[model samples]
Target: MDKVKFGVLGCARVFERRMAPALKSAGNAVLHAVASRSLEKAQATAGKHGAAKAYGSYDALLADTDIEAVYIPLPNDQHAEWTVKALAAGKHVLCDKPLALSVSEAEWMAGAAAASGLRLMEGFMYRHHPQHKKVFEVLRSGAIGEPVHFRGIFTYPATADHAGIRWNPAQGGGAFLDVGVYPLNAARWLLESEPTEAKAIAITDPTSGVDSHTAALLAFPNNRTASLIGGFDQAFTSRYELVGREGSITVERAFQVGESGVRVLVRANNSDTEEAFFFEHTDQFQLEVEHFAACIRNSELSLEPGEDGVAQARAQALVLSSL
Candidate 1:
């Protein structure tokens, strides 16, 4: 099997903790380079991640002939710009979630990818995790019997770092763009449709000029509705529940890791019983990298395409706008 050589577009903290290791461990991918505005950071990331090259400029990474793919962990606002540039340069792109700051930007990205005939994917790694697949299978198997409603919550208290990107307005910092995206994405993926209508509320930080907390109600087809909550002013909590006519599917840790397994507790209406589905623990990041490599090797785009990212972004934007 030929390994897909990967060039990382930034030395973002997310890459150091998650994506870099995933690329290193994946059997079908190689971490070939990392680029950052700072040469020191780029060199450090390259050394730590076994990257063959380090470039001080993003453009330099794009120029590498050996790198067929680029993993973009840039800021939320920069996603579309870099992705369009990478696609135009004839390199496959795997951009971070909330693919762009706006629907129009995301549309432009999708267009660029189609025009270039290069693989373009938004990084919604959780959808590739086996546990999520199990959730889909159960839903498809009628275990839940017509999933009618979904409730998702993701929250983690933010540090008082005023300069952090999550608190910066120019870089697209807000709870809705950060943790909020997970619940929104989960709802969309499970329902497999775009949100038709939305209402939302937000608590804003006067100092930071960003929403510290946000809650939204999304109306989908089939008279279905989903409640999504994301915040930076709460204790760590991540969970989602899908309620149907027959039973309910509850995921304990909807978007994060745990020791044992994610519970898929199923309960029928009249029965005082529950069936638990146990899934083996695996690194979701590694699974994501493997899937990305598979898509590239097969000369295909990602399972979670740029459009999915765009849709999630649009939903998030609508929620924010409603707030």
Candidate 2:
């Protein structure tokens, strides 16, 4: 396929503001269709995104033979069900983060994808950003010399609307499932190991019955450890610091690297000097879309494959259980 045709499974705000533009920017992909429960909304979104078709239901979009892949930005609880359905319909899937609410569901989705011989990937746009690659390169260069600890914070004030999906517990609303996964995934990626133990403390909202704030601790092998804070009712902050034997590295605005330049700060052991590494901004979502399209064209798995989603969900389940 010269260009992989994509069908968006929802007209969610994230799709309108981010993924739609990303699809337009991706070199090897096209925004071919969109679907929503409401036909008018679907048509409006399709018009805005330049999709050729719009459907009143997700099933209709899945049935469209022209759509070779589906980008699912549905609620966290809906990811596995729709991903399995899309795979059954012969469409590769790029599901938004928290690929499933549970490890079992993630494993089931992965199994379905494998059975259908289709590619399935979780949408972690930050991993595709050039800044993260730079960080990895710096780490590999021994600039941070054997990282021993990671501290990450991702938090933002929640809207007053208690009816919002993000604040609705029945719909899989919570801080941990939303933004907490980023820091946890970062810790695992940077350490190149899964956490051996995990624990978390959460503050549940009185009215919403969902966790409004959470702090988690993960212990990896080699005596390495990580502390992560995520909250839905807090001042806006997103950053991380990796401490090593020789030095430390800090990333500001870590999760949402937007289109502006970002900086990484490095400090050597016993040195007051802090060096800054700047990275020109790029569209990470576009890169993510292009990479998925490439994997589909080449008949290979994505860099963040379905199994990775399962691993993430497993760790998440462990933490949630502990909480």
lDDT (Cα, tens digit) per residue for candidate 2, span 1-323: 58999999999888989899999988999999999999999999999889999999999999999999999999988998899999999999999998989888999998998899888899988888777777887788887788999998889997856878888887788888888888988888888888989889999989888898999999999999999988988998889999999888889978888567899888876477899889888888898999989988886454553358888888888789888
Relative to the true structure, candidate 1 reaches a TM of 0.96
Candidate 1 versus truth, CA RMSD in Å, comes to: 1.5
Instruction: TM-score for candidate 2, please give it.
Output: 0.97
Please report, as a residue range, the 10-residue window in candidate 2 with the lowest summed lDDT: 298-307
Taking the tens digit of each residue's C-alpha lDDT, what string does model 1 give over 44-93? 88998899999999999999999999999888888988999898878998
TM-score of each: 0.96, 0.97
The global C-alpha lDDT for each of the candidates, from Candidate 1 onward, is 0.85, 0.88
lDDT of 1 at 263: 67
